[model samples]
Target: MDFGANWKHYDQAIIPLPPDHPITARTLSGIPGPGTLRIGSSGWTRKEYTNTLYPKGVSTANQLTEYGRIFQCVELNATHYKIYSPAEVQKWVEKVKNKDFLFCPKYPQSISHHSSLLNATDETNAFLDGIRAFGNQLGPVFLQLGEQFSPARKATLFKYLESLPEDIDFFVEVRHADWYNNPTELREYFKTLREMCIGAVITDTPGRRDCLHMGLTTPDVFLRFVTKGNHPADLKRLLEWKPRLDAWTAAGLERIFFFLHVHEGEHEAAFYKEVKEVFGIATQETQMSLF
Candidate 1:
């Protein structure tokens, strides 16, 4: 969210590119009909959500259970900081078992940012092993290449990506400016994803418009939407995504994991309430399918 913080320092305007051309399935393959759209926040334990999303005096230990009753999924960011024990993973899994919920964990920072995806076999193995405990409750496990990683270090990226187990789905978010600046490199980057059957994480933030490359390496789409506040500008930017998401859904895009990030202290409940309305995504009443 901090990456493209234009308004924080800018005479420059926060102009999102006009919508891209309609996204068609890259190949002949696709899901049978309109696919699922999973809408959620980056986390559910926000104090802002207390009493509004959570009960007025819900215990901290019971928050995740309450969170499962509302949102369809979560960006399980706690996993990004470190490898967790299997018992802890199972404890989380137990809380949401009644609902068709998913825990979309991220690559642990120890493996991803600290070791930078080199010779961290023990860490990688332990991380993957622990998350696999989610069993059927697992969503796509996403890996974000460090901002310092670039096309120059693609071999390391690919090696790690290719080594990932096929059973669990994955999406990759590349932050390097090089991946988006050059058309040829971008094409090759996506081509590799298609070959490997991994998806791409399309990010839309104010300062870093290039990260909003709307390409689909796989049918499933994971979107990271960062907004400034409840300002009209923020709503306008979110509205821009409606048509693009609509087109993809009509084209049978499999899943949409839309995570909204706004500066803390803003009314997040209001922000996402409006987002759900604008996107015409499911309301909590319609969440019987847990999507």
Candidate 2:
């Protein structure tokens, strides 16, 4: 009974997956079905994808080819960093399909970082509509609001979300500590999200609870697993975190999609394989990274 010991290490030996683990009938159904399916990495643009897929002299097109051979989805981070033309997204959507890949675009930085919530205007919708070339394969349109925290922002955000079609899955990721500091206001903001049936983004960062505590209040779960390191110690932390993710799956939420983001995608490939093993995603191919 080491009650005073560090509880973080308590689950170090606890296996993340069960021996009897099998892919759920639901996941099988989602292989082509709609809800709660999809796991991938963030930002596979020219640089990140090129570096990850081909560290040395890997042709850009060959890199994407390799990516299609591996990951089924990628967070379209460039969408936020720049205003992409419709032609660009269309070309992207046309490039890959074999692995049933999907794209989740982040809201543009102009809309999120520079303006007040009340000032969203038609920019967000226009941006999304511009990329309709992806169609149903568009996955969730992630609204990653940055460090701006205010009631006005929340209200405007809810309005912008309300404007989107019901078919378009929306996910909200707030980075500021202000929202988490006041649980009541946070829950209230989440209440708007619930009413709109929007999924809240579950971010696993350093020094945080990670999972959403107010799940009963929301309809869906979209996760972004940004690992700060790929060390064995980090792997152990990730193993410990899986049970908590399992708890979300158990809660019967609408969806779950995790993207691996760390320093070394090549080495982290092994750790991700272990994660897939733990989670019972029994595809033997280590598809997320290029080694």
Candidate 3:
């Protein structure tokens, strides 16, 4: 969660950026068909969510079940720090069993952070083997390269991505600024993802507006929306996304995975409610109160 903590100072600062080009949507039109949209927070194990996002005295072990009662999906951030065993992954699967929930797990740090995509096959295979325990419940596996990872290592990154099992979905989030600033590299990066059918993660944060490159290389989108604790600007930003989402859905984007990151757990639930309202997604009543 502290991946981009350096930008925390910009939480209250607003930067105006131009609207997304229609051409980007036009390019995304090549996607085959319309996809389902899933909205949820990063994780559901926060102790602070006890009464606000979870029922009072709700056990930590049961939070995922409680969370699945409301949200359809969650970004499994725990895997980003350490790889888990198949048993552990299965435990998670059972926790959300019988619910229409999906888990988008981040790639293990061994593959993404420690090694920088070089000779990561062993670690990648181990990570994937564990996550595959989710079976049909597994969503996209996200590989978030550290900010130090630059375009200079694009070949290594691409090679690693190409080696992934084609049956499973995968996404990549590059934090290096050069990847966004260099026109040729950006185009090539996306073009390669399109060719490989790998989804590109679009991160919407305060300081790094350029990371909000509305390009969809695949039919699906994995959006990381970092909020400033339910700030008014947060709602405004989601409102702006509503129309774009509609357009993308209409234009053949298959699956949309939206994960909200807020400083407080209550803000996360509040924002989720607002997102559902704005997008007209239905949800059942839950015990969590956003007060």
Candidate 4:
């Protein structure tokens, strides 16, 4: 959650940019089809969320169960730092088994950071094998390359991506400005991902506007929206997204995983509420258990 903490002080200086013209034009042209949209925060266990996101007296053990009652999905951030055993991932799967929930786990640092996605077959397999325990509840597994993972190493990166198991869904986030700044490279990169059936993550944060590159390489979208502690501009950004999302849905985008990043857990719920109200997207209702 503190990934973008350095930019916190610049909150007042951040101004929302106008919509990306190419994306807007495409959306308006209509790519007709039905789609599924899931909106939720990165994680739900923060103690600060007590009585707001979670019930006042809710125990740590029951947080995920309670979170499933409201949000349809969550981004599992803990996995990025440590690899979980299959049994451990299964425990999480059991917690939200009855609810219509999805868990989007991040790639472990051993593979993405430490090993740098090169010649780390054993670590990669171990991570994938463990997360496969989520079965049907598994969402996209995102590989967040470090800021130093530049375009120079793109061949190695693409090779690593091609090596990933095809059955599991995967998305990638590249922080290198080269990927966004160069028009030809950007188009080619997106085209390659589309052909491979992988996804590109579109990040929206104050410090980096270029990271908000609005391109859909696949039918699905993985949006990482970093908010400035419930600032009014956060609401404004979400409002702007409403039309863009509606257009994407109309144009046949299949799924959207919108993960909000806010230090205050309470702000997540507030943001989701605004998205629902403004976009007319319905919040998912939990299924009742027969037991």
RMSD of each: 3.8, 7.5, 2.9, 4.8
Write down the lDDT of every candidate, Cα atoms only.
0.79, 0.60, 0.79, 0.78
Ranking by lDDT: 3, 1, 4, 2
For candidate 2, the per-residue lDDT at 26 reads: 23
> Across residues 48-117, which tens digit of lDDT does each residue of candidate 1 receive?
7787667899988888898888788888889998798888899998887455888899889888888889
Model 4: pairs clashing at backbone N, Cα or C within 3 Å: 31-251
Over 38-117, each residue of candidate 3 has an lDDT whose tens digit, in order, gives: 88777888766778768999987899998887677888989988889999999998988555799999888887888887
lDDT of 2 by residue, 166-235 (tens): 8777788775666766767676766677677776676554334423333433434576655534455556
TM-score of each: 0.90, 0.76, 0.90, 0.88
Error of 1 at 106 (Å): 0.9
Stretches of candidate 2 off by over 4 Å are 1-37, 45-57, 210-219, 282-291
Candidate 4: residue 159 Cα off by (Å): 0.4
Checking candidate 3 for backbone clashes, the offending pairs are 35-254
Off by over 4 Å in 4: 2-31, 281-291
Backbone clash total, candidate 3: 1
lDDT of 4 by residue, 32-110 (tens): 6566878777786877567866778999899988888777888888899898889999999888745569999999998
| Evaluation by TM-score, superior candidate among 1 and 2 | 1
lDDT of 1 at 19: 51
